[model samples]
Target: MATTSESEPTTVETPGSDDQSREGEIFDLLSNQRRRYAIHYCKREDDPVTLGELAEHVAAWELDKEVAAITSAERKRVYTSLQQTHLPTLERADMIEFDDRTIELTDEAAELDVYLDVVPADSIPWGTYYLGLAAVGSVVMAGLWLEIVPTEAVPELGWATLVFALFAVSAVVHVVQNRRMRLGEMERPP
Candidate 1:
């Protein structure tokens, strides 16, 4: 019979590169997607919620409540009561003097924050960049029509007519550009 060493599990700790004293393992209490959802719900939350309310929210999202009900969730729910709810309260007291760079977060929220950023700011409309370019193109076409191209010299055509002509040409170019963009083609036409 092989005897197992019962000292304890070796926890992974981060390097103490900074002055803050959070050198030990950062608790990934909110790492679980369900727990994260609950925490996010709490972040938006006006006040601290009871465990029962959080459990209800997590349970509601369960497509297979029968499966998650037995092990991961039921046990996890109690664990979450400690991990997601109580531990956070405890960790609130475990604060290192905020030196600005030192982070105090679970392994999950820290990882997530890398991607999602910590700020609760609203999202930018990326489409606005395209719309803005289109507006600039219109303005440039107008300038070319009014200033660069002399219409009367081309016979009967006025500046307005020149603007319309340039706009027509630009429309073709715009459509082609849009088509290429939709197809994810970046090569310029030769």
Candidate 2:
């Protein structure tokens, strides 16, 4: 009996794997609204901010009011939550560096903006809205094709142009949204 040695490629973890793991961690840490608010506040600031300032912004956001309207009690409540819970969790996830007095975002924290989407209540989801637009555009096109709608004033090509314009505008908006969602990357204007 001959014993044969079989060779198999050993799997090595890529650098991207580390990034993916950190991204997952970031998503988990940012799952809480307070944590998300903390990240947004940190990104907006040019310098490291005190916990008090962060809490004020968070409290204001939570209460759906202006920062000037944030009461001391409200601020303190958010401050305590941040100090004990959110900040530490973020720090653990390597999203931010925190100490007793001040906290600052790390490079990893910059990657989190992509996951934070703020949709207004009155607005429909983008997918649904786009579908509705396409439906309307299709009906208009069909009307023009079948000569059911009056096109004597406006040329058939004009109706098609309107549909095309609508789609083009929507595409531009979607591109802008995608650019905003880019994490840790800067978009430079030519």
Candidate 3:
């Protein structure tokens, strides 16, 4: 039997090693709501923003208040929080390059957008939406089967075929949209 030297290291190939590492890092960086908000604000910018401006916007968003309505106290609170805590955390992750004066996003940080979802407050979750669709589809199919609805207007097999096609097409569209967002090529729809 041959024994390997203790000083020698072996390389192991883990499945999706790089992607998994990146995904974990993204989750880490975005763990905090404040950090997510910072990324959301930064991702839409055309240029580097002053820390003050960034703080103001972030504060407004956090408070769910208008920028014009933001009080001096609110501004100061957010500014201090970012300056002392959040900005340093993001800087260490290479998500953003933050100076005492101005802040800018890094290219690596752009990849973070893929992991963040921007769902509207009023909308239902996709899982719930799909469940509702399935329920309605089942009821419609049952109606067709029992002749609760007119067969002359639409046959049972024909109705089921159309419903399945609609779902298949909708699923395809949903997948394409998800891929686009996951690639960081598109922002979440408002």
Candidate 4:
């Protein structure tokens, strides 16, 4: 006869539970402005910049290659972030090769850098721009659609003007609704 014997517990440990660190792995891959700058600095350097120099360089950071000067404390954070956080995580993914002296992106990482690599400072999604255009189009289209002047009746100037004004009001409503849709504020009722 088959019998129920025992059940093992499922223990979820925050650390040392798995061979990988998910949070670290992700942060390594999705580099922000500062992290990318660190990588760029390493790639461009002919020699290893000391932690102090790196720290200094990071402080006066204006995203300029020809920066004026570096500060003392900024160098420390740069070095620590580069070492404990950036270098090890990148090394695991083969994004960069690290030795005692320095760290740099691997040939593969550099080559693959062309795709989904870094977010440019000025980059803006085209969807937002197109949506703004759509708002303007809705207004113009609504105006033309109203057709205040009926060819059959040939209404008097005052009546036609009043109708045109009403049409213009409708156009304004169209523009407002379009704006809401573009912003994802339109709700579907259940």
By TM-score, the best candidate is: 2
The local distance difference test score of each candidate is 0.43, 0.77, 0.76, 0.51
Give per-residue CA lDDT, model 3, range 14-94, as digits (tens): 999988997887788777777776766676664788888878888887888888999999999989999999999989888
lDDT of 1 by residue, 1-190 (tens): 5455788666555676442343223234333455444444343343455555445444544433432344555645654564545445534634211122222333333233222222112533334544665676677567655675454466334544655665677668656644443211222110
Least accurate 10 contiguous residues by lDDT in model 2: 181-190
Worst 10 residues of 4 by lDDT: 181-190
| Residue 179 C-alpha lDDT in model 3 | 56
Which residue pairs show collisions in model 2? none
Question: What's the lDDT for candidate 2?
Answer: 0.77
- Each prediction's TM-score versus the true structure: 0.29, 0.69, 0.67, 0.43
lDDT of 1 at 50: 54
Candidate 4, pairs of clashing residues: 55-74, 55-75, 56-70, 56-71
lDDT of 1 at 115: 27
Ranking by TM-score: 2, 3, 4, 1
What would the TM-score be for candidate 3 when compared with the true structure? Answer: 0.67
Which sequence of candidate numbers ranks them by lDDT, best first?
2, 3, 4, 1
Better of 1 and 3 by lDDT: 3
Where in model 1 is the C-alpha error above 4 Å? 1-32, 62-190
Predicted candidate 4 versus true structure: per-residue lDDT over 1-190, tens digit per residue: 4455468555557766453574455454644545555554555563455544444455446334333444445556666776777667667777677774466556655533333322224744334544655666565455445764354554455554655666577668556544443211222100
Give the deviation of candidate 3 from the true structure as CA RMSD. Answer: 4.9
What is the TM-score (0 to 1) of candidate 4? 0.43
Q: Clash totals for all models, in order?
A: 0, 0, 0, 4
